[model samples]
Target: MLHRSLPIRASLLLAALCLSTPAWSADPIHKETVALTAGKAAHSVKGQIKGYATAEYTLTGKAGQTLSVKLKTNQPSNYFNIRQAGQDEALFIGSTSGNTYQATLPADGEYTVQVYLMRNAARRNAVANYRLEMGLRD
Candidate 1:
């Protein structure tokens, strides 16, 4: 009887551990496309994000081209992350507390920029209305 109870306890512990994790751990990520013209382009997008919601934008350019990104949010705790398309990890772009990112593409393909609210802020049931500006230089 004691051995049977041990297994039940372990199952409850595992369930608790999973529930305590952050919502962003598996939130749906929405995607958008950025259009470039004449080897250069700039765009501004506006939207609202609630809780742990995430959004991503994709653009294609040649290798060695420069990309500039800026995010302005109504909430101070919102920021953006840049990563290569088809990848799951974000690139380390200096301090992770800013709304701006700049880098050169390592290869010629689609790159993704992710916008999300900070974890601490998201937990408080916060919402952010933001504008994302992007520029690509050829």
Candidate 2:
């Protein structure tokens, strides 16, 4: 009888724990291709984001070429991450570092620049308007 009661108590505790945990409301991620001018090495794009929504821009790059990214945003919590085509983790984190990132690409492939607001701002439904500038050169 005691064992049965213990199991019930454990189940209730588990349920409470699950309910107590805060859940994030998922928002759809926006996608776009970074199109540069036919004879240009850089391009800039303007966009808006809010909540948990994200904007991802895909661009092609080559190894040994310099990749530069600058994100200008209306909100301080807004940031971006750069990830190689097949990677799970970001190669650059804008939140920890600043909003500008420049590196010599490691491989020749597609890269994604993801823009979003921090959780603190996202949860508040704050909006951010931004301009993302990207360039690649030798």
Candidate 3:
């Protein structure tokens, strides 16, 4: 009876060894960049997003990659409305005031980052001078 039980224990150990082997892991995506110029507008820049807005030059990303977005502005105005592929993700909004705005991208795909002036009682159409930076992480 002991000899028969010995074979059963050996088989269980062998099965556990096979299951313990590690599987392959996928690689992480690399960092990328996009640029935006002045003089691009949507319907209007009111409470939602008003006045002239500009978007990034490129919007290509890898699968399963984390995208870190940063927006640097010169002056403190209503510089808001940074979207991912024409969607209102809002990376930065509601008065950053000559500062940098940051956000993270969820998935790998084509994403568009936009910046615009906020339209309110002040109602001034000033030229937008800004820069965008994107990075990747695990």
Candidate 4:
């Protein structure tokens, strides 16, 4: 009787294990760094220019997983915009005096960030260089 009961217990344990979610199956965290450079041609006829110092990053995660993004700019601008891939929309657009920006992602996928300089001609001439620090948060 004891031996016969051992087989039933083993079968039950196997079933439970099969039904359990796999810990390793969860999506892995990803990150990448990108450099941006703007030249004189990027400026307008009046020498006023506003463009992005962009960075490209690939994100991989489960369908329902949440993604967080943070960005640090070299300098504050009059306005800025954040664009995502496959969506004809802007994630964020507004004025910022601070150098850092943050946002929560809607889904799991690859995203591209473009940090534009919103300074006017006078401000543009004041800036000859800039840097953007971008990252993803789990």
Return model 4's CA RMSD, one decimal. 19.7
- Residues 41-90 of candidate 2 have per-residue lDDT tens digits of 57999999988899999988888878899999889999999999888888
2 or 4, greater by TM-score: 2
The window of 10 residues in a row where model 2 has the poorest summed lDDT is 34-43
- The residue-by-residue lDDT of candidate 1 on 1-138, one tens digit each, is 999999999999999988796644776677898886524547889988887888888877778888888888889888888877666777634236477777787778888777888878878969989999888886
- State the displacement of the C-alpha of residue 5, model 2, in Å, after optimal TM-score superposition: 34
Q: Model 3, range 87-123, lDDT digits (tens) per residue?
A: 5555445365333433455555566544555545225
Candidate 2 positional error at 31, Å: 0.3
Comparing 1 and 2 on lDDT, the stronger one: 2
lDDT of each: 0.79, 0.89, 0.47, 0.44
TM per candidate comes to 0.72, 0.78, 0.44, 0.40
What does candidate 3 score in Cα RMSD to the true structure?
A: 18.2
Over the full model, what C-alpha lDDT does candidate 2 score relative to the true structure? 0.89
Pick the winner on lDDT between candidates 2 and 3: 2
Rank candidates, TM-score, best first.
2, 1, 3, 4
CA error at residue 37 for candidate 1, angstroms: 2.8
Q: Where does candidate 4 clash, by residue pair? A: none
